[model samples]
Target: MNATVAIIGRPNVGKSTLFNRLVGKRLALVDDTPGVTRDRRPGDARLGDLRFTIVDTAGLEDADKATLAGRMRKQTEEAIQDADVVLFVIDARAGVTPLDAHFAEVARKIARPVILLANKAEGRAGEPGIYEAYSLGLGEPVPISAEHGEGLSDLYDALREEFEKLEAAEGPSEEAETDIVIDPDADGEEDDEPAGTVDRPLRVAIAGRPNAGKSTLINKLLGEERLLTGPEAGITRDSISVDWVWRERHVKLFDTAGMRRKARVQEKLEKLSVADALRAIKFAEVVVVTLDANIPFEKQDLQIIDLVQREGRALVIAFNKWDTIEDRTEVWTEIKYQAERYLNQVRGVAMVPISATTGQGLDKLMEAVFDAYKMWNARVSTARLNKWLEGVVAHHPPPAVAGRRIKLRYLTQAKTRPPHFIVFCSRPEQLPEAYLRYLVNGVRETFKLPGTPIRLSFRKGENPYANKAKKKR
Candidate 1:
């Protein structure tokens, strides 16, 4: 097994900054506030030629065993136990505090190969803290400015030395290796369509209003209380991402804080949480908008769905807490009718009835999520698109504007993943929005693409002699 390194430190000491530096992605939320991270997140990290798993853990603190801080501390302790090496970081600008010393003692008791990292040590100003770290009983401190990407060579050397010693002590074992190849053109045709692959992990985000059972549904999918949940609204603050395998297919699930209406969101913390949820939706390929079945399709819920569609993300509507509702048939009919009438931009979005509390209809929900993802990344042959365009134009032609009939020439798919199309025609600006919507709906229905945003752009076809004629004139 590859060596795993865990980062542990007191709050606001730049552990998350260093974690993001090493992981090469901002997977963890970083802010000035203390205790931003409450759960452990792992990523594959690379330094020079070395590759291993690196875990970013919550900050350690002194609190009652029953409190939330205590639970975070337990998570950090668990990460330490599972790690082959530990990075105990300290804030060089603030110098060592009592909390640092307390955590240093805890790290010593754990007896793991600990590397002392004096973060925020960009210049000579951090000298005092570097000197103070020598008294913590850990060896020479590796001073680094993770945000500035400095002193990583020394950090790499320290990690390599420890990893080598461990490997030498354990010796070698026989293990089978499998090679994974990624082909860029695997998802589309070679002629006109862009090539891609679905082998990547599905990125799904669960979002809705506060206390809409978003976290509850994710917990049910994980089959564990990986997330903290209760009757309390807005229990989730940071957008926590968890990796799981469903039926041997890789899936990355993001549980975000519930979104509230802009005017209703007053607290600074809740605003940050809502912004984090928005960021999650922007990054996600498929977003499952969870709603309380008892009060489905509220104004806020409609607004959330509108935002998702505006972002051009594949969407799935999950009616959470379905078990609590009494009249299933009537509710389902109303939901279908409302979705058809209201969400006409992307018609036929998948709507699944689920109970996050009782684990009902989760299978259908995931199946719909995968289906939406597939359709979102779907590609159509140019020949097929042109044929469909021909038929649609024949059925209902483009309207005339100012005594001139707009000529519809040709259509070609420019991209996928919320499929975008380019149409070459005359007087493109004369086309009405309703006419464009007609073409988009035709493409969606003809190609079996549903629940995914469709984009169409019109361009006037180029004339070879136009430039020459302009020059002569």
Candidate 2:
């Protein structure tokens, strides 16, 4: 594992800001509101030339053992335990509150090294807190402005000192740390694996209406209460991601807040939560829309599925709380019928009946997830695509448009992962929308790619040398 650094602090102490700064991406959500982040998020961080794994954790809070804040503290403690170095952050503008001191005491007990960071220290704003941080028994605080990107060089120096000591203690290594290298023009002949391997983990997001047991399902999959779950409708506010291995495949599971309809989402926090959930869906390769078995396929549920299809992501439908139903066979048949009748945009979507509380039918759900993802990334050779296109045209040719028959020359796939195809045709703008849908449906059925969005476009191909010939004339 890469060296781990954990950032810990009280709520609104700029931990997420520092994390975003180091990682050079807005992976974590930042807001003026406290407790916006409720989970431990990990990312690869770089400081100048130094690189390491950095973890951004929820702020420590004092609460009873069973409460949500208590669970968040538990996650923070776990991050501190696994971390090689702890970056204890404080809001320099606020000047070291009682909560910061409390968490600092806990950090001091740990055997690992700790570095105090007085964030928001731009233009001498955090000078008082820098001095106050010395009383916490940690080393001198490194003043930093996480928002403005200031004082990072000094922080880098301190981190480099710690890493140098670690390197000295662990001795030297002859082999390189990583074998992967970027070469834009290199051919594929040197690689040993015949088929390319997907090194990046598959990103799957579980989204649905409130109280659909989305978090409960992922917690069961992880075999731990990694996320906060309860009877509350809006218990989850952030789109939290957990890294897991399922059947030896690395999968990054994102559990998003329950998405409510636009008219009902009036609260500011709920709006933010819904936006985060939509962002998760956009980032995900496959989305499993969970439904309450008691009230399956509500208008909001169909709207969520429609959103996923419109976003061009592969989809799987999951019926949650299946153990509550008395007549299982009849409900299952009805649900399938409704899925076909209602979700016409994404045909042949995999639907699995699962009880998140009881852990029943999870295996089938995962199998369906993997199957849908495979179809989403599937690609067809141009030769086979053209042959299929010929058959399709021969069966049902394009009708006459304004008295002349429109000719479609050929079709070729432009991309995969929601396979996109472009057809060279005459009068592309005049091609009817129904004809395009016909071709898209044909592609889906012919390629066995079901439940994945397929894009088909018609383009009039122009001769490349025509411009040059005209100039010569």
Candidate 3:
């Protein structure tokens, strides 16, 4: 097993910057604002030859047990308990404050080792603070600058020492295995895997407006309070991903921050959060849009759904807080009507009513998710597509324009995973928008493709004899 290390500190001491440096990616949201991180985010980290699991946690704070700050502190405490080693960080420019000293005492009680980090110690400006950090009495402070990437070699030495002692006491562990294979004989070329055949985990992202219970739903799926959720809107600020095994199938679930309307999002931190959520949507194969049953299909909710459809990802609508609704039958009927009326582009999308707090309809939600994924990766044969096109053209021929009829000669599927098709036809520019819509709807209905975007493009057929004219002599 990989050694687990946790980075702990008070607010705005550059703990997240160290995490980004170690992981080699900007997976966590970083800003000048205090308390931006509220959940524990894990990533595989590599420093020189040492490899381990690193977890970034929320900043430590003191507050009432019922307040939000208290809940955040609780999450940090959990990380501290589970870690094999802890890195206690402090701002060298500002020196050690009362909060740091208090937390230092807390770190001392940990049965494991703790490395003191005096961050932002780049030049002479940080020397005084770095000297003052020795009073905390954890150990010799490792002076480093997380932003400029300085003094990491010293940090690596400290970590290597601790890891060596740990290995000596515990003995050699079984090395973790991986499934990727590297080829030594191949030239530089891209090897693309076919859809639905790669042995990778299925990626699913949950998104919606503020106060829509997105985190609650993900926590329920994990069967633990892995994510922080409460009677609060926008408690989650970062797009955190967790891996799990659902019914013997590997799945990766991403819990994103709640997106608010553009006008209401005035703060820089909220803007960053919204952008992070958008990135999660682009990376996912299937998106589950959570909705509050009491306020189903609000203006913002419809906008979110439209964005997902435009992105060409498979979609499933989940109506959360189902237990609080009084008239279930009436509400469900209205929901179906609204979905059909507004979401006519991708018809027959799956809608599942669930209560995240009570675990109602959880099984049906997973089944719908799997069903949508199957449809998203579906492929149609070339012969079947041409035959289907023939029947469609015979029933309703293209309308004549300028005394000439548009003739569609052939049809073929270019790709799957949001299936895209190409049509070779005469007068491609004259084909009306209504006619294209008819063909798209026909493909969706004929091939049992629903709730996924279908892309169809027209191209004029090439003249086969044009290149042969030069050889006529």
- On lDDT, the leading prediction is 3
- Worst 10-residue lDDT window for candidate 3 reads 189-198
Query: lDDT per residue, candidate 1, 244-359, as tens digits?
Result: 88877778899998999999999777788888899999999899999898888899999999999999999999999899989899989998888888889769889999999999
* C-alpha positional error of residue 426 in candidate 3 after TM-score superposition, expressed in Å: 1.6
* Residue 409, model 3, lDDT: 97
Give RMSD (Å) of candidate 2 vs. truth: 3.8
Please list all clashing residue pairs in model 1, or write none if there are none.
none
Q: Mind sharing the TM-score for model 2?
A: 0.87
Q: What TM-score, computed on C-alpha atoms, does each candidate reach?
A: 0.83, 0.87, 0.94
Error (Å) of candidate 3 at residue 291 is: 1.0
State the lDDT at 393 in candidate 2.
82
Clashes of each: 0, 0, 0
The better candidate by TM-score, 1 or 2, is 2
Candidate 3 C-alpha lDDT tens digits along 1-473: 46899999999999899999999999889999999999999998989988899999999998886898999998898898889899999999999999999999999999889999999999999999899999999989999999999999999999999988888888766543553446532553322332232256678999999889999998898898888888899999999998877777667889999998889999999999999999999989889999999998888998899889889988999999999999999999999999889888878889999999999998899888888988888889999999998998899989999999889999999987789999999989999999999999999999999787889999999879878986885
Count of clashes in candidate 2: 0
